[model samples]
Target: MPGFRLISFKRCPYVQRCVMILREKNVEYDIEYIDLSDRPDWFNELSPLGKVPVLEVTRDDGTKVVLFESAVINEYLDEVTPGSLLPDDPLERAHSRAWCVFGTALLSDAGDITMARDEETLAGDLERLGKKLDRLEREIDTGPFFLGAEVSLVDAAFVPALQRLAWANEFHPAMAIFEGHPKVARWWAALADRESVVNSAVPDLRQRYEAYVGRDRGGYRSLVGARIAA
Candidate 1:
């Protein structure tokens, strides 16, 4: 197999998704970490939106193609790899895709909660996220993974968001984001031991994530908590 290069940022959940998939598939790939605030000129040529997780595939014949966006990258990878994370039926695949989009929305709204400027806004974001989580809870199958026996694209897609919530709780137990979502919580607990998920980010991911959220424009300084950094 021709090894690929992953242009990545250390902390972006979007990038984590792709990295996890590569890890899960046991693909031959190398990651080159880049600071989002100080990207090189060629990065603009490769990534239209200047995002992390731009995969550069060098074919056996020396041809190269750069792909961007986490979703597109995941889908393309699934297609090329032997085992499929998506469903075989067209309708089921479409449904899975829709859920992946929903997962993205959840991640976005959670970011809003982290950056909520006031207690009122924070409470509102929490309520909205709570309602959406209830929907997700209802949607969850009896699973160690998203679809029961197998882990799907949905699992890889949403695990990063779930991970962020878990780390945030370590600093500020206020959110209780998973309170009413037992199935989602279970799914997260299951992924906790997954090697692919574990290797996606740095070993000190909790601290890094906290540092970023601690600087949120909102009153999220609490994300760092009182504990001293190790």
Candidate 2:
């Protein structure tokens, strides 16, 4: 509507990434919330996919840049802003960016696990998710953060995922996703404590997310003997 307007959904992790980037950059932007199940027509004009975290940049000259996809938007913001969300070395930057893709893939895998109807399907999806987590565990070194001290785009990319998996572990205590991932556990705990990550989503989110996951006609609620179902 003004300088910068971020179209968002109250609980989307992708939108949260953009929020974290905005907080990191200290950029003041307006936000308009929407329900994904019932999107407004104008939203289609803003995003081809009709998704949230769409940034509408209205420059002083009156031209506008409406951008979709959280990764692309955050990357553009880093270039325009003073500080870097990625590494200085080009190779390191590329590697970090690839992890960002992996982060999204992790989300997909988790969703597949969560929405899996059968024990067999859940087992397969869990293995896939576990393999991804193993890869993430292998990359760990010194970290109060994922890539090191200062929070990078990789950290931004993963804030949503880490929290969800943490909740998943909570919902079913026997299903500890972070088990044997000490470095990742440390990284997750630190990131969870950060002001940027804390304020990224709305309050009472844990309750809301838990309710959503356990809703009627669901797989998550079927936390039977199977660990993944749990």
Candidate 3:
């Protein structure tokens, strides 16, 4: 196996997903943690998109590749690594990918929606996420894992979001998406204990949430107003 370097940040859920997948695959890579508020000049040169979780992949033949986007990075890492987080069966693979999309696309957006305090749309958000969980609860009957007996990329992708949900529920006390979902509660708890998640290669989220929410009440308003005017 060759060496790799992961350019990431502490509080980004997208970055967290890449870290978990890399660790789960047992791929050895050097981590370069960046602070979003004051990103290093070097990072900007590498990721023109200015996003975290950019992987600097080095091959044994002295070739290098830099990739971005959390989902694409996870898929790429899985390609080079030994373990298979994604299923081989076409149907199962599709099903797993659905949850991956759910976590990254739909459920992940809920954080921004909630922070925006658009509580009126929260019921609809809960409905959509709940429906997915209802199906997931029914699909996995074999034990603790998402796909029968073992964890899959589907589970890995969602764990970080679920963790933040738990934090929000615990502190905010109003975002109660997990109130009635027993299966999701169980799965979230189990996933938290996973080595990749527990030993998060990043900082705590509560600090970020506090800062984000504070800004949401103040700076977010001004920023939105400025954008609209433009």
Candidate 4:
């Protein structure tokens, strides 16, 4: 078996997804957290895109290979593990992959909401995010996980965004991110307590997240987050 090393940024949602997959597969690996603002030379050399969640694979033959991008790294991890997180059917697997892309868009929207500079910007961000959530609610046929009862790669992809949105909603209920989106809300509830999801990030992630988004960032959401943190 090849050994793995994951390069991560402490608060990156992308990195969190990789961590969740690693834990779900019960894969033993070493994770090195780096300061994204001051990335080390080794990381710069390993990551072509200069991104987090870079996977370093060391084969038994002593050859090393580097992989970047969360989605690709996740697929690689899933394929190497015992049971597959994707469906056996090709079309079903493609459908899951498409939704995984949607999950990344959702993550981007959540980031926009956190960094909105004014009420107008915040309102627009909320509207865009709400539309995506509505679409997700309709797309989900079954509850708990994205595809069904058992967790899939889709769940690992979506959970980080859902978790962050839930936190923002908690701090500012007016966001109403989950309001009227019962299916998506249920999905979030289901995965929120899973061991892999819970331990995907640092223990003080909430505090760290709040501080990042709210800390004198000059954004309207930051003001709200700052007030709540205080």
Candidate 5:
């Protein structure tokens, strides 16, 4: 019934990014959860790339607009919404964007290494990720939120990654990296406490990840076991 539709996969980081932005902007939009294996034909027609977090804007007059990529969707929402997520101050905005990009990039790298389930590299990669968290802790001021006193797009963008990182640590005891960084732990805890992060999160990650891994040509143990043993 809403004017916008977000095509998303529940566990996808990119989709989480878009959801976070939409929630922060207080935008009303409908969400369609897509099965990656059996996507709806309509979605394929709209986005040939077949990626999730696609934003479809339908005007009252029946015009349709589609956008792919979480960053683009976030920018679009910021423009359309009355309140700004990125500050008007150029320097602050740049710093905020830098933090978002940094969190995403670090998490992506960590995911790649973790997904391999390699016994040797998992520890090292997790350590590197922990270092990034340490940096974030150093960068941020005292916060109930990321930009000092309030939640912003940067806070939303990074929170899901922190959630995943925590999951990684919980599943894989070897990734107890944040234990040393109290600030990082507090930041993550605070971020996770938000309504948007809570509402947007998908709790079936371990099962989905297990199924996805099972489908691979080279089979591995359940993600839970792999993490426990790794």
Candidate 6:
């Protein structure tokens, strides 16, 4: 395995997923946090998609390769490291992968919730988010994680959205994101204190997330978040 460098923005959930995978794998890597609003020249050249969580891998011969997309980067990291975070059974592995994609959709809904500009929009976003959570509640049969005891890449992918949603619920109790979703709620609690999940983001993530979603952006959540902060 070569030296790893992760290009990230502090508030990016995708980058946080990569960070969690890196930590879970115990891979020694350097992280460079950049301002997404003002991306550097090198970054623009390095990342074709112009997104955060671009991973720079330094090969044995000092050659560099850049990998994009959280799912691809995470799988590569898992493959190069010792054990696998994916299930061994082919069907199970594919199932996990499918759920990981589902997690991405959940993240998109989360983004929508945060950026909702009005009550009607927020209500609609919450309804969409709730439907997804309902699906997760049905899908998750295990106690602590998506696949029972051990935390996997699926957990890594989902935790960022869960954490943010937890915060949103806290900032505005009316959201009640976990209501009627006992299993998902339990899953969140289970991963809440896990080392990788806890340390995946910046120490001030809660404050940063609040500011970014609430006061910093012009959204209804911002109004609610700002009021909570005040």
Worst 10 residues of 2 by lDDT: 220-229
Error of 3 at 171 (Å): 1.6
Q: Compose the digit string of candidate 4's lDDT tens values, residues 89-130.
A: 999999999999999999999888877767788899999999
* lDDT by candidate, in order shown: 0.81, 0.81, 0.72, 0.90, 0.74, 0.89
Which of the two, 2 or 5, has more lDDT? 2
Q: Which of candidates 1 and 3 is the stronger one according to lDDT? A: 1
Q: What's the TM for model 2?
A: 0.91
TM, every model: 0.92, 0.91, 0.82, 0.96, 0.86, 0.95
Q: Could you tell which candidate, 1 or 6, scores higher by TM-score?
A: 6
Model 1 RMSD, rounded to 1 decimal: 2.4
Off by over 4 Å in 6: 216-223
Provide the clash count, candidate 2: 0
Candidate 4 structure lDDT: 0.90
Q: Candidate 1: deviation at residue 216, Å?
A: 7.2
Ranking by lDDT: 4, 6, 1, 2, 5, 3
Cα lDDT tens digits, model 1, 149-188, are 8888998889888887776555557788778788988999
Clashing pairs in 1: none
lDDT of 1 at 92: 93
The parts of candidate 3 lying over 4 Å away from their true place are: 118-132, 135-140, 219-230
> Which 10-residue window of candidate 6 scores lowest in summed lDDT?
216-225
Instruction: List where candidate 4 sits over 4 angstroms from the true fold.
Output: 218-223
Residue 102 shift from truth in candidate 2, angstroms = 0.7
Q: Can you tell me which runs of candidate 5 are displaced by over 4 Å?
A: 203-217, 222-230
Give the higher-TM-score candidate: 1 or 2.
1
Indicate the worst ten consecutive residues by lDDT in candidate 5: 209-218
For candidate 5, write residues 15-111 as lDDT tens digits.
8888877887788988988888888898889885889889999988898889998877888888888878888999988888888888788668556
